[model samples]
Target chain A: MSAAGAGPGSREGHREPRRAVDGALRADTADTADTADTADTADNPGLAARVTTRRGGFTLDVAVEVAHGEVVAVLGPNGSGKSTLLGTLAGLFDPESATVTLADRVLTDTDAGITVPVHRRRVGLLSQQALLFPHLTAHENVAFGPRCAGQGRRAAGAVADRWLAEMGVAELADRRPSELSGGQAQRVAIARALAVEPDLLLLDEPFAALDVDAAPAVRAVLRRVVRDSVVGGQTVLLVTHDVLDAVVLADRLVVLADGEVVEQGPTAEVLARPRSGFAARIAGLDLVTGTACAGGLHTLDGTLVSGAASEPLDHGDPAVAVFAPRSVAVHRERPAGSPRNVVPVRLAAMEPQGEVVRLRAGASGRGPAWGEGLAADVTPAAVAELGVEPGDELWFAVKATEVAVHPSGR
Target chain B: MTRAAPSSPRTRSSRTGSTGHTLPWPVWVPAVVGFGLIAVPVAGLVLRADWPNFLTLITSDAALDALRLSLQTGLTSTALCLLFGTPLALVLARSDLPGLPVWRSIVLLPLVLPPVVGGLTLLFLLGRTGPVGQLLDAWFGVTVPFSTVAVVIAQTFVAMPFLVVSLEGALRTAGDRYEAVAATLGASPMTALRRVTIPVVLPGLVSGAVLAFARALGEFGATVAFAGSLQGTTRTLPLLIYLDSQDDLDSAVALSLLLVVVAVVVIVATRTRDASGVR
Candidate 1:
């Protein structure tokens, strides 16, 4: 509903964007400065947008403000309306209600009865398939945008060459799209989207079709090209199902489920403490499902798991109680506590991960969660100190507030 | 369990007629007879042609007039098919306009109609005394039937379905994905249509036009009945051939051979280009 903290989360814990890729280009501060010298980014400062669209029975209501040069990755499951959001912004569909503006230009404001046509919207969209015009060469494919913007063939061809060079696919320019490898075609498609100097960019699962070997190369290109230092940080909305795409390239993360923004924050923040099931699964956390009762959650079979709400839910409404595995504290005995949420469980498995051991526990020594249930990330030191191993009985305890309850993502 | 020898080129050659029998005698018997039924009539025409006098027969004044008329009318009809029939096919492929199937069937009617039947329908619709034709006669004082224009109209009526059907299939195969992508790249609808949609379906359009041209060239009953058979005006090659059949049987056979050659050439040329498909 509002735009707050729209800039990307701090770029930390990421692979160096400037790792010597192909031994030719390095995405470093100098590269950014060099790009700033060549391109005029000040003319297109990123703008905030509020998008609301309803298709058939599905309605997606989301507001996102992409800071100048920030990449916002919209992470969601299939049929969760990620593509719908991008399509609405790109002027493919006139939303039921939306007010989308990039910089001073009003692309779509349904209330004002002003909806720019797609070609005039200045929002370049790339989908999972590169969809290169088969009849066009890679050079001509990249030139298409500039050509459509009224550049002559020679000038547009020059622009295409420049972009192809920047993307490290210049040598393949003359080859038709059918002659291009999947990765090469995707790179050209990306270059084509940027050639027109659009104010906003929308990528719909851009890497989903690429093999694992080709994805990282394109990801590197996005990191180097889409950053504020290089391309003047035009606002980009990347719709992806892969967490790695969010972690590597996105500054902010907006997790959608069933056409609603279930959780959103800095890429690291939401990932650190996912509040929804889809988010939690992608973030690698344990999420317990239940219905909200007077005091806490009532599991499917009426087992009570007490937890505080990150956002309040009406009693009897569906809810999912979620917490990071690291949040659970495993104990050897039933620890005495004052109204703390605690459960007796059998330690199903213990696997060492870095400095910590991943512990899988069930509801109790006898229950459906007997073999695999709650997961807790404890230090390898703790595993040694507590002498915990597979099939060991233990008690798991957590502060009710640490486990966040929210409306079900379904 | 007993097993037959593994299939190799050597073994397959032995199994087939090239070496010995592979299929049963009954299968080849009916199939070859069926093939000969079509082959014999075509062979008869080819064999009956007076090769030495073929050029002289075709170059005769009446034959030349008819040949010229056929070419002119065929070209005009094909042009009309491209101009109007392509848009019709686009509408059929892309739109949900009411009565769509009815319109499609109407376009398809001439394809299945007996040439004489098509000619009769056109004669009724455009005859000087008919309802619509009467209005045109009153307003412009232009009669439609039994004229050069009428010949083209008759040819187009029979040929247009070929063009529209081919184009609709092409448009459907090309789909809207490329056009949608083009729009996102800042292409206006018209630009996308011209630059993306048209080029993508060009092969289909070409084949359709070629087929229409061939159909128009061969049109006889419709052109003769609706447009009349007048030398240098409405009479076309097919009409000339039919009229010649009553007396000059040798010339008619030669002309028939030429028509068969032209049709085969047209089909082969277009099909080969499609098989090669734009690389």
Candidate 2:
């Protein structure tokens, strides 16, 4: 295969043009970044790859790039091919049509008729379960990777001790996997993966099995290891169902739904403006797509609303409106206020959502002429003061600026 | 809260008694019969044995030779079984080879085959004029039938399935997660098998070996049929008992008691080994 001379700057600048060839390759940007970053350090800039899969009636095609000191998260729903994508990237499964390039070497290229065996791929994979050798002590588990790489027994043990110390689990070195707690075991597993100094690291729900209380600590430890350049410009691909984790730790989020990239961009951008209902659900936001008009934004079914109008809307121009329930202010009466959009509504119900309370209400007969309910998020203090209850009449005021508008179409 | 009747506690106690009733005589009758069926044979062995002559019988030259040969052949057979069965079990349990189910059946064939028939099959395969036997004779001048080595081979053929089946089940249940983890750590398949797979399944292997050894020690029909009975050569204790029973019932009974003692010793040794292994 001929090597492409496109530099990182060119790749980033022409992302849109390259995306036109295949949307899957566009998703490959995250993996490419990883490869480029590692390549910059090792005199080889092709250490990242993307894999697409067609399996069991679902197609999972994603492009990812990882740079050294970068943590790329593959975020999606259950059965969204997150695990399969990770597996394929790690050479556990061969994609029907995909290209896997690492630095100057092509690990797999269906078009070029190249496929490397998994064991020789030098990719370290950490599954949800730590999967430590039960019979081996923590030190032995960490040493296993180095020993397998052909280090002498004494040398391997020394190296393992160093890693264990770095991981802050040196005291547990002699304890077997069964003896270690979930957090400790994961630390050892991370150490084991890093011991081999793999070019790429694959983590499949590494924190899924951890308790909620233990997850943050483990996540922090993992972030330190993967993000540290001392670990040799490691590129990490983390697959997770937790959006919070992706938002907190990932440099970019690639959302997969039913085997397709429903949304992929910077973590904050995707979270802020999810294009599909699937992405909205993942981002914990309500997404409503409609046509903008001079009077207000019209629902797809032609229901008109007197809400704050964004820029002068051309009739039938596609637009997306996204707002959090907390942004909608609920009122018991139509009080005079500076806010422009205020619609009388009847309280549908109230549900407690963690620290916030969700109030479901419908706009007075003038709202969308179909199944439509507006959700308002408020604090317990606000709910108490407003005496919000099902069947109570209220008014919802939404600021036009709070209602973000994005043009439709790719 | 209600005022209790005088009979309340009595009634409650009686109800509990009824609920806790034991099995009736009908159940015990068959259970007792089954126990007697197993116990009667053991009683007969004790009743017929010549207790006083047991020491003398065991000390006889022929008896001593047979005992020694039985120990040597049984141990040798067990070693051979382990040598070949472990790898076979690993492959059967771990590999995705074609027709594995059929191969599994073939590995287990000896268990269902009559011991004598199994011995005959081995004899046919290794006999002087047998296909592989002729080549072995031509190339190495080794004649297998009616020899001590033949005894070990016959015993191994019958006893190997015990080890392989047990070990295979252990391997399958153990799963490949550890091995996968080892591979990711940079260990090759062989190293993973050695450090992760073998250590994890060591208990199964050890127990399987013990069971195979016990089975080989008690093996009679296959050993006698394939290797033949030759005093001081191929005559194991089982064969000696068969030979003496024809005219010397007392000596035969004494040999029977000696065999029982040896079996008990082996069982105790195995149990001790198993305990240590687990520890």
DockQ of each: 0.26, 0.20
lDDT of 1 by residue, B213-271 (tens): 99899998898889998889888889889999999998898878877877888778877
| Residue-by-residue lDDT tens digits, candidate 1, A1-410 | 01223212311101122222123322222132222211222344454566677765677777665645667888988878777788788887767887877777888898999888988888888888788887678898889888998999999999999999989999998887656777888898899889888888888888988888989778767666876365756577889987667765675688887777777655644664454657867767555666887666777777777778644567876666666788888888778875366777887666566677878774464543312467789988788899887878888777777776654421
Q: What is the TM-score of chain B in candidate 2?
A: 0.85
Whole-model alpha-carbon lDDT for candidate 1: 0.75
Q: How well is candidate 2 docked (DockQ)?
A: 0.20
**Candidate 2 segments exceeding 4 Å error:** A1-47, A229-233, A285-410, B1-49, B137-140, B264-279
- Best candidate (score: lDDT): 1
lDDT of 2 by residue, A1-410 (tens): 10121212223422233333344444534333432333343454434555666878787766665544456678887888887877776766778877777655678898888887667778899887888876678898898888888899999999999889878899999986756777888888888888888878888888888778777677766765665555854667778887656644566566777887666665545665455667655666433456767655666767553344433445776554556677788888785867655667788777787898877665457554222366678999998998778988788877765765433321
Off by over 4 Å in 1: A1-47, A285-410, B1-40, B272-279
Instruction: In angstroms, give how far residue B44 of model 2 lies from its true place.
Output: 5.6
List the candidates' TM-scores in order: 0.73, 0.73
Task: Give the whole-model CA lDDT for all candidates, comma-separated.
Answer: 0.75, 0.72
